[model samples]
Each structure stands twice: as C-alpha cells, then as structure tokens.
Target: MERILREPLETYSTQKTQKFVGNPLANKLRGEYQRLLEEILPDRNRYLVVGSPGKGNWASCPWIAILDSLITDTAQSGYYPVLIFKEDMTGVYLSLNQGVTRVKEYYKRNAKNVLRVIAQDYRAKIEIDNEDLTEIDLASRNNNAKLYEAGNIIAKYYPADNLPTTTELIQDVRRFLNLYEELIFNDTQIDETKNLTALEKKQYRLHFRIERNSNIANKVKQHKGYKCEGCKFTFSSMYGSLGKEFIEAHHLIPISTLNLGNVQVNIETDFAVLCSNCHSMIHRLDDPSNLELLQKIIKDNLT
Candidate 1:
C-alpha cells in the first residue's frame, strides 16, 4: 500500500506527459496490487478485487476496490470498500462508498448531490464502524475525486507518510466488508427512496418478497380484522387517524409454491392480518405456513 501510494504518482505523471497509450501501472494495480489485497481476505471467492490506474486517460485519483461478488463485480455499481489514493498523492482513503457511475448516469450533472444524499441514507440505518468517518477528503477537485468524496458513506484516511500496518489494514477491510454486507448485500431493510440509483436489485428484491394481488389482498384484509393476529396489535388504536384500516395481508403459504395441483386460496384460512413487525418476523421462519409455530415463537418471546 505504501508503495502503491508513492510509486503510482510519479509513474502516472511521467506516462501522461509522454501521451501514454498502454498502462503498466494499470496492469499492476489490477493484477499484483489486487492479489496482495486478496491474500488478506477471509474468503477470496466471495470478493472480486480489482484496481484501476485510469481508463483512457490517467486518473488523478486511482483506486483499488474490494467488491462483494453477489452485489457487484465492478465498481460501477453497488457499494464496496475501496482504497482511493488522494489526487495530490499526499494521502489515501479506505472508504465504504457508493458506485458513482450509476449515480452519474441517472442523476447526470446533479450526481454529486444525489451521492451525498444516498450516503446519508445508508449511514442512518446501519451500524457504522467509524462514527467519525461520515465523510472523506480526496484533496482534489477532479471529477472522480469529487464523486468519490460525495459517495463516501464512511471512511478512514491513511496519510501517505504514516500508513497503518498490514494487520491493521486487514482489520479495517474486514470491518468495512461486514458493514457492506449489512447495508448493501443483506437484501432486507432497504428503506428511504425506492428510486435511489445503484440499488435496483436490492429495492426490487424487497418489493418482490410478497407478490400481492391487490384485489385479493383487499378482500382478505376485509375478511380479517385490521389488527395483528400474531400479537393483537391494532395500528389504528396506536396511531389513530394515520393508521386507520392499515394492516398487511400475509399469505400463510409460500406464494411461489401455491400453484401445486389446481390450488385455490381460501381467504379466511390462508391469510393473516399482521402488523409490519409480525409479517417481517414470519418471513424469517423456515416454514412461514406454520402459523401455530409462529404464534408460539412470538408468545414465548413476550413472556
């Protein structure tokens, strides 16, 4: 990392001055440096490590990102833990960051603003490793650096002269990866704006958890009282006007497997009127169809 911080600056400048075409530094960043970082990971197969010196032109702030394989193979989308060398080569940042490419494409000239907004949204919900690292500084106004700074959800800076030991670096990466799993790859708790860019899969997955037929749902809710069957919690009683007639209709049987034979759903027998909490809890069960077991679990917890 120390070598990466120091060596790249001089090499980049020299190559750019001569109107460089091919990049040896890019090769090293993606190959050797990436391999070095990969060695520290607990399971390398779960991560996709990649580095970039620049694209067609030399980047003022080059980076090497460790991406979660399930979420993103490239840094263009989803979130990742990245090592971004400062534009001035004076320092580097280990950032838990968003992918700027997707943001830029969607938000265009206002991408920076949206990136900052999404970063705030991410920080609000998850447990952050570093409470102080809510933002980062790349010390340059380059487009990439600016986007990276705005996209930072949380970060720890490493000054060029005083970098951490390899062990410490590995620990930080592991901590950041854990956060990444919770906030980005967990496929649950995706809140805030559904229209937020770079989170198509997560947002859709959360929405797709229950494929509801609205007519059937309304009829089912009519048949069942507007109270949580699991805990007898009434939303209207708690919140008054805002929660009137508000209750979720949950299908006891898995919707995907409902097509077995010539299946027909009976609203009274197959549906449950649950509060959001109970509905979410039931989905975590191995067999959500077992309403008796779910009620027992919830009852035991209360006692």
Candidate 2:
C-alpha cells in the first residue's frame, strides 16, 4: 500500500503519470484504494470508482482522485464526493469536487451555508478560500490545507497522526451531501413560479434531467455491446462500419425520481443501450419511456 502511494509521486517527479483509464499500474493502485474505502463504508458498492494516478499535465503535481459514481458523470448535475491522495502530502483527503463541473457557480452561491452544515453536523474542521473562485482557482490553490478551494470545498481527513477511520470519513461525507441536497437541488420555488411560459418551465425542469450518467452508459455499452436494447438493432451492422461503436445511452429510471437529489443509480438496472432511432422514440414524451413498453411497441410493429 505504501508502495502504491509512492508510485505516482516518484513517477511525477520525473514526468506526469500517464492517464489511468488503461494503465495497469495506475489501475492496481486504484483497486487498492477501493479496498481501503470498502473496508470502512458498507454501502461502498453503490459508489463508482474514478480518477487518475496523477494529473497528466506536465505542470500539475501528483494526485489520485476517487469519485462517487453519480457525481462523476459529467461534472455538471451531481456533486462528486472525492477521496484524494496526494503523494507529497502525508494523508488522504475527503473532498467535494464541483470545481471541474459546470455547476461550480451554483455551489458557490451556497458555500457559506454548506460550510456551516459541515461543521455543525460532523465536527470536522474545514477551510474555505475567502476570495471568489474562478476557473483559475483550480491551478492556484494547492499545498495549503489552510484554505479550502471556494468553488469546490475540501477538508483533510488523514493528516499524519490524525487519520480518520472509514466510519468517521463516511459520516463526514454523508453529512455534507445531505446538506448539499437540501440547499441546492431541493428548490421548489422554481416549479411554483408564476412568470414562466410553458416552454420555459420545460426548459427549467430539463436542467435536472439531461445530465447523462456516462459511467453507467459506458459500462452498459462495454458489457452489453452497442446493439439497441429494445430492438437489437446494431448501427454498425446496418451502416456497414460507419456506425460502428455508436449507440445511445438511455436512462431506465423514471425522471421524476431524479429530482430527489443524491439518488444512487444502479448501472446494471438503471440504463439501456439503444440506437439513435429507438432512443429518440423512447424519449418522445417528456418522461422516461419505459424499456418494456418500448420493446412491446417494437414487437407489435414488426408483427
């Protein structure tokens, strides 16, 4: 384990560590990290594992990021509960990374309240940057555990002698996400607004819906193959190589349930692989078109 932690730092001192997506060594290190996380969190299976052994850019320092599956989707719709291991730094950190996502501003608006909840709920000491956080915030803030990155706040969990157990770490993160859900995604006022047109309201609701869980989609495509889940239509087979490897990801879970915030998505159960035509037909209506329902429709048409 110490060797796993030391690998990136050693690699980065000479050059940036390569991307973790297909690297065996980097992946093994993440597997070890997952083992450590699972030992502490009983519900750890629900979380998707993500991040790289080190930031690939030549200028960036060595770091490992393990992100929650739901939040790791696209960096826009959900909050990423991250566990970061910095080679130069002594211990791992429990952080909420919204900085890389499109919703950084949304998090910034409620940062103060979010910090308060973290402190009151978990008894964890946290730090926040006083200045306004911008895109540059990502490059500038580092090494100083004293100031939390404002756009996406973070707190140290394993600082040398004061390493937190898995239970303590889980409690801290859960408390933080609960408060985040309450403050950000639970707004009912927008739905109740008296001023918007029908089309406008539709657009408003879409902000919560269109964010794709790519991890689930990619996993489904890899395991299930790129054929349409409903009709078994293979784009490549039909179009001769031009359409190879191209398929759409459809969310099988009902859309109404997504607004509840922090909902755990079961990749195997919640998504389907589809061709473009079937995907469009399924979502022709506002709600998620049911998989079984669509299958029946296709069967009937063929008959």
Candidate 3:
C-alpha cells in the first residue's frame, strides 16, 4: 500500500504526462494496486476496486479508489474513499471525495459552488470519530484538483517521508471501508417507515441525496436543455453564471407509483427537465406528468 501511494507521488510529475499511462508505475496503479486493495476490501464482492494514472492523458494527481457498487463503480460520479497523490507528490490524502464529472454536467460552469455546498452539508450532518478531516490541498490549480478540494468530505494525510507500514495502511483502509459501507447503507435504504422519535432521528431522516445518480440527471439535462419544459424559462437567462445549466429532472412516472424492481427510466422519455419552481408546482396536480395542465394553470393565474 505504501509503495502504491508513494511511487506515484515520487515519480508521476517527473515523467511526461502523455506517456505516463504506458509507464510501469501507471500499470501498477491501474492493475496491481487494485488487486492488493481487493484482498483487503470488506465484503470485497460489493466493490469494484480501481486506480487511475489518468484517463486519456495522465493525471497530475493520480488516485487509487475503492468504489462501492451501489453508489458507483467509477470514480467519475459517486463518492468513494480514495488515496490520491498531491500535485507536488509530497503527500497523499485518504479522502472520502465525490466524482466531479456529473456535477460539471449538471451545473456546467457553476459546479464549484454546488460541490462546496454539498461538502459543507456532509460535514455538518455526518460525524466521524477522530476522522473529522476538513480540507485537502491537492497543491495544484488544475480543474480536477479544484473540484476534488471542494468534493472532499473528510481526509487523512500521510507525508511522503513518513509513509506507514503496509499493515498500518491496511488497518486504516479497512476501518475507513467499514465507515464507507455505513454511509452507503444509511443513504441507500432510507425508510421513513421505521418510526423514530429521537434527536438523532432528525439527522437520520436528513435527505441529502448526495449525487445518487447524477449521471441520469445529466442525461436528462442533455436530452432537454436547461430551459424549464413546463414554463420555457431558463435559469441561466436570469441568474447568468450562478444558474448556467441548472435544472431538475422531474419523473414523469412518479417514483412512488413505479415498481422499484426491474424498472428502467429512459432519459429521453421518462424524465422532464423542469426548473425548481415548475418542479415543485407539478407535484400539486393529481398527475404530476401533466405538463399541459401545469402550463394552463400558470397561464390562467397570470394577472
């Protein structure tokens, strides 16, 4: 684990970025490092362990992540625990961070603000014993670096000079993995059905649906631009930079009505991209899918 974390920090930037992927170090991160983590990952079957030197071009700060199957198998979208090297390679962070890609698609130029808001929300709600890490410095001004800095929920740092023993690293990883699973289980199965009347109950029922499937949302946005399908209003028109590419995906088939099992939502047909105002108003109707009725109400209400 130390070697996996150290080699990239020590050698990644020294090597040219374009050819870095073919390098042995990159191969080890992409292949061998994941196998070592596979051996240690809890309920190992539930995770798709992966590491990245970069996608097409080499990353300035490379990472090896333990991604959960329920949230996402890729580092591109869901939150996951990852060991990412700093830009300067002086240290690395064991960080619970988010995937910036989907956020970028949803918010376009305003993703940084959205990511920061989410990080703040998570920090406020979730409690980690001694791992109440606040901020991370990837030490670069790269776009991904900036996004990662905002996306970081919590982190533990290890300096390059003082890398821990493989066993210690393994222990830390396993403990963090357990915490990761706890976050997933808590978030994935939100049953308000089970009655709870405690102070913590409010926190338990806290609905911060942290990018559960922002990809689907992105696809909906892609199919229907940021304009409100119900009102033909675009957020960016009024709010400019703050509202660029902003819209919510409203389910044409109400989630409560649909069978959770074997139900597939087609991005092109099953969802409507509505501004938040229209999104809320659509639910007032008996059939939320009836955009025609929603439009008529708006037209009639105009004075």
Candidate 4:
C-alpha cells in the first residue's frame, strides 16, 4: 500500500481567497470532496460526514478525499476498507495518534532494505529548484517552517506519544498508497477477468439449468427412496427439497458425449443418483466406465 500525501488545509487557500476574490473555493472544495466521497462509500449505507460543521477556516475537504480514496481504493483491490471518521476533538486526536502508531509498527515489521527502497522511491519525486539560489533557499526554509508548524498543530491534537518514527511513518504511507493504486487499477481487472472466466466455465459445464437440475435431483431422491445407492447417505426434505444429505445425479454417459440423433435417449440414461463424494469420484476418471478402475483402487487401498 502506498501512503497518500496529506495536503494541509491551508493548501486550498480558501481563507485568503474568500476575503479577497469572493470565489467560494472552500465550499467548492467541500462539494468536490463530498462528490468523491459518494463515489467511494458503499451504496445504501449511512455514513457521517464528521468535522466541525460550518467551520470553513481549515478545509475538511482534503481529509474527506483521503478517506474516500482509501475506502474506494481498498474495496477495488478486493480488501475491505474501514474508515473511522473523527467528529470531535477526542476522536480526531485518538485516530491521528493511532495512525501514527500504526505507521511506526508497520516500519518496524518491514526490513531495512525495504525501507531504503521506499525512501528512494519517495525521494525520486521530490523536486528542488536551484535556479535562483537565495530565493529558492528562503522558499525552502519557509516551506519547511510551515510543515513543522502544521506537524506541531497535528501533534497537539493527536499527541504523538510512543508514536512511530518519521521514517516509519513515511514508509507506511508510501506502502498504503502503492497498494491502493495496485488495487484500483491492476488487481481489479485481473480479479474481474478471473471471476468472469470462472462463471462462464461453471455455466458451460453445468449448462446453468439450475432449476432443472434441482427438479431432477428431487425426483432422483424420491426414486432412490432418499438413499445414496453407492454410499447409503440418506436425506429428507426436512434438510432440503432434494434430501437431508441430498444425492447428486451423475451422467453415466457425459452430456458432452451425446450425438445429435441420440440426444433424447442420452439425456434419459445419462444420470445416476450418488452421494456427493461418489459423484465427484466418478468424474475423476477420463470415462464413466472407469468407475471399475476406481472401485479396484478403493478395494486395494482398503486391503
């Protein structure tokens, strides 16, 4: 999982812009954040949009985007995404503290080599301008100062007591974000294709006549007095419509073996009611007549 970078609320520049330009950047950010949230959250499930309601000073939009992205990304990756929102001061502090702790724990578990790889990956993207030396240095210092101040404020609320180191935190975040990307883009397609192929095979092999099979199974159960001829496993309607243990009807001659002219006769003679295990074992052989071979093997194994 790659860690997503958390943009400071000031990044929206809403406070400065709201006074000067009259352009509602904060409200716009909030709306976009909510829309992104709707895309991620599960359908027909209630979720609380937790924040200081109507407090538009520090945009809560970034936090919402992070939560939505995390949830959707995790789900898309075939993993359950659990998002806990902090509505109050206590919850916010606790969650931040927990996040910090988790990040550290994650780093501790991973190897030093892995950490180095992660740092390299992150460092590669960091851009530093050297064109205007004095101005660039000043800008860099200011940015660092801002970041430090922001970190302090976050720590004030969260209180990073026994929290993970900065290095660990960075690594964890990188891993989380990476995983999210993989799930959202790569793994999702592979999973969908795999599922579709499996469904098609199932449909093709079983002919997907579920109702017909169920009816036939029921009739076979009644005909066989609800007893497996091979294993004597008895089933009744109390357990299911088919039986308590329900026998499977196996084709002595496979459906695939049917000729055009003999289709009707083939369907009629193709089935036998056997226990589930027995039915499976019957199909283990290349040909149904090779049940004799299975019987021999079983007798030999038993002896």
Candidate 5:
C-alpha cells in the first residue's frame, strides 16, 4: 500500500503561542500568509488545514477565515480551491477536487516540499520498495493513482487556461462540493436504503443488523428493547437520533450455506436477529450449529 504523507504538526503538538493580533491586523496578516502560501504551494487541488483553538485562544477562527479567503481568491483567479478545516488530526480530511489542473498543479508543485516536512517529522520517506516495480510503474502509467494521477492527466489534457471565467471556476467548485458531500454524508448506509431496488432494498432492510461493525453502531443503543433470541441480550438504537442500536438481523444460514432449493427463499424469514455481541459470537464460531452453543453460553452466563 502507498503510504500517506504526514505533516509535522500532525504528530507533535506545536505551541501556537503568538498573541492574537487586532482584527484588522489579523486580517492583513492572514491575507499575506495566504498569498505566500499560494506562491509556495501549488495552485492545483484543494488544501486541508488541521488546526486547534489552543487553550482558550481564538486563533483557529482567524486561521479558518484565512483559508476561506484563500479559497475565495483562488476561485476568483479562475482556479478551484477547496479548503477543509479539520478540528483535529484524527478526523478524516475532507477535500473537494474543483478543477483537474488545480489539483494536479498543486500536488506536483507542493508534493516534494510537503513530503520533506512529513519525512522530517515522521523520520520516514515514501519509497517504492515493492518487488514489482514494474507493477507499480504500470499502475502509475494506467492512471490508477486515483485522486493525484488522474487529476494530473486531466490537467495535462485540458489545461485550466481553457476554463475562461471566474463564473466557470465557481460553478466547477460548487458541482464538485455537491458530489463530494453526497458521497461522504448522505450516501452512507441506511441513507442508501432508499436508492436500492425494491427486492434488493427489501432484503437490505430485513437483513440489516446493527453489529459493532456497523458505522452507526453508536446510534443503535436506543432500540434494544428487542432482546436477541440467541443470546438474550437487549439491544436498541436509542443512542443518537439515527436509532441504530435496534436488533441486528443476520443470516442464520449463510447465503452461501443455503441449499439449492432454499436459494429462492425470502431473505426476511431466512435471517435471524441477534444482539451485537451475540452476532459477533455467531460469526466467530463460523459453524451454523455454534448458534446453539452461543445460546447455551448466553443462558449459562446470564442465568
């Protein structure tokens, strides 16, 4: 797997001890900083800045403002810029690719310097040590690098100079943001329940089990009024508003384990509901008969 580059401040907590300047001066400084960043960093691809407010300080607010201004200015200059403000380093970085060239140019110009910082801090470098350099080369050649390489190809094939106007840049950024938001937030899990076909969706709903593995596991704690028949452990989706904790439905007989005649059976009746722990235990045994053993264990432990 290709290793991701990490920033210096990412690992160690750097003290941003600079006193908050007055609003006007702070704005001026922010503009200058952003301009310098534009000069040093690539104009392509969006930027993600991980910032902290730091012990009763409001510096992050100004920092975010600076980022917003930078993105706005880049948009006006006919370049797409997506600025993501991460509250901490642990969260997944959110970024939107505005225009092809914008991201390509950004990475091409900034990757080395960025990698240098990452290397200095992490004491590591991105090296292709794979035995199959040919495979790696072929992957790179085939545009398999997804975000980075694909953007470069698009930039090379269709330069930003062809973009023409600020309006076009804004429109491009907006469209990219919309698609990105949909993929990240709305298209996840049960939200996708609506998009599935009638049969597929019915199966999904019926067999939808909220295991500890589920993305919305935290939300499922509230709906545990229904106890798992296998383990006798109660479950609910009452934690968050999403109500994810309810009974998790699972296939008692694996889809693959089904007999030829039962292949066409309804999924709802074919599945069994189990609590999170019981569901895990069921899968842990890997044998269908283990469900009975799991039930016995649960009965012995609880009683």
Candidate 6:
C-alpha cells in the first residue's frame, strides 16, 4: 500500500504524471489519498478533490488538493489545503493557486503580502505562482517525512484530539478570508464634493449621514424593539418614551456597494440597530465594526 501511494510521486516521471490521468495505478493512489483525508476531515461535502495525482501541468509535481468551498466555488480561483509529493521532498501545505492569483489582481491588488502572513501563522510553506510546487520542499526527503511534517504543523492549529470538523474549519477559513480582506483591502475614503458652503467646508466634518430607509429602521424597531444590538442599550429604558424609537440603524452591507444602482438591501440581514454611542463608535473606525465584534468588546469589558 505504501509503495502504491509513493508510486505516483516517486516512480513516475514528469511526463508520466501529465499523461497517466486515467491509469489504474494512478487512480488507486488517488483513491487512497481521498480515503485518508476522509478519516481526518468531517464534512466531506465542504471540500472537493479538485486536483489529484497525474492531473496537472507537465512541470508540476504529483499532488492532491482539498479545496475550501466557502472560499471559492472552483479551484481555479481560491487557495487549497494541499499535499504535495515530489521526488526530492514532500509537504502538506496551503497552495494559493490560479484562482487566488486572479483575486490578487481584481479584489486585492495591495494584498500581495497577506498570504505570506497566513503561511507564517501555520508555519506552513508558501507557494505563489510556481507550477512546480517546489517552494515547500525544504530538503531532500521522502513522501512520508513531508506528510508527517505538514501534519504536525496542521495539528498545531487543528489537533487530532479536538479536530475542527470540516464545516467548522471552513467557517474559520471564511472568517480568516474576511479579516484578510478587511485588513488588506480596507480603503479609507473621504467625501470629495467640491464647492462646499463655508460651514460645510469646515476642517472637521462632524458627521456624515448615509442614506437609509426610515421604513426599514422602523420595522427593525418594531420586530426587534429599540435595543442596541451590540451593547443592549435600550433607549426608552434609559431616556423614557422620548428615546423609545430613537435607536440608529446601521447598514451592514459593505459601504462601497450601498449606493450602487441595483444593490438590494434586506433589512433583517443588512441592518442592525444601536444606541447613539455604540453607533458612533461603530463608525469611528475607517471600516465599521460588525455587530458580533462590538458585542464581543462589550462582553470582554464587563468580564
């Protein structure tokens, strides 16, 4: 069985890997890899074997890549949890492939260095555009050595005793991607309207009101009541009936897309009500803090 597993990586030449996609031995090797991954991963549905032995460009080594579906619908655009085995070395690592390359161009031109930080977090090797997938090869070693080393690094973040079920891991990865997008692509924009009146052109603009539907705000007040979703500040309780319907509505959608012509906003999912103070603090940062984060801050402060 070990020999079968090693055959695709060790015995096969580069040409063989490219041409042996349908070969019986190659299929068996690929199947075994999937079986082993199934034992380690809980939600088989969350991942797909997008790349396998004997199914890559001629210059690339034999590898199996398990993709996180939440990050990308296809392997062509997202990163993957990859197990790469080459004659000189092997290691399980994260490979940001063509899909990620595309994202680097379109969504985050400034984020070229973010993946390096993620790799450092895992202590996992990084590979950008090299089809050879050889950047992870640290020294001359066997396939099992590489797998063991990679497994240890993965186990550090996801231990065997408390393995993150595939679903949990996918969610974690999604959050990581969100934070990455937030940190790397966060752009601070200032209103640049020209010919402001003397008062409007003041050095410090005290506030800017983003347009929102008053009906939606009223519905939230009706359904959820006028309690701050973050710190649970109730206006009526604090300030009598005058404050009953005074909670501010914050749109949860990305600020960049809020005014797009065809953009749709679902009140329940897209808005949160907050007390005056919390609302001000949420927008204090260049990017408004999400309600969950604000709630965490409140909880943390009390505890």
- The candidate maximizing lDDT is 3
> lDDT tens digits, residues 1-303, model 3?
567877777777776444754688778888998898888765666678889888777787888889865356568776788998898899998988888999989988899889888877665655676655778999988998899998888888999999878998988887777667556545544445545444323333221121235656777788888889888899889999999999998767643445422335677877888888997788666566788899898888885
**Ranking 2 against 5 by lDDT, winner:** 2
Query: What TM-score, computed on C-alpha atoms, does each candidate reach?
Result: 0.61, 0.43, 0.63, 0.27, 0.26, 0.34
lDDT agreement of model 3 with the native: 0.75
lDDT of each: 0.74, 0.50, 0.75, 0.34, 0.34, 0.47
Q: Candidate 4, which ten residues in sequence have the lowest lDDT sum? A: 131-140
The TM-score, computed over Cα atoms with residue i paired to residue i, of candidate 5 is: 0.26
CA shift at 294, candidate 1, in angstroms?
Answer: 22
Off by over 4 Å in 6: 1-5, 14-21, 29-32, 54-59, 87-135, 138-303
Tell me how far the alpha carbon of residue 20 in candidate 6 is from the true structure, in angstroms, after superposition.
3.0
Error of 2 at 96 (Å): 0.9
> TM-score for model 3?
0.63
Error of 4 at 245 (Å): 6.0
lDDT of 1 at 33: 88
Error of 2 at 35 (Å): 3.3
Clashing pairs in 2: none
Q: Write the per-residue lDDT of candidate 4 for residues 98-203, one digit (tens) a residue.
A: 1122223455434333433433343333331232111101112232222212211011122112333445544433343343333333222222332334433332
Model 2 TM-score, all chains together:
0.43
Candidate 3 colliding pairs: none
TM-score of candidate 1 relative to the true fold: 0.61
Q: Write the per-residue lDDT of candidate 1 for residues 205-271, one digit (tens) a residue.
A: 3233332545567778889879898889999899998999999888776533544223356777878
Per-residue lDDT of candidate 5, residues 151-225 (tens digit): 211110112123224444334334444333233222224435235454443333333321222323323323323
Best by TM-score: 3
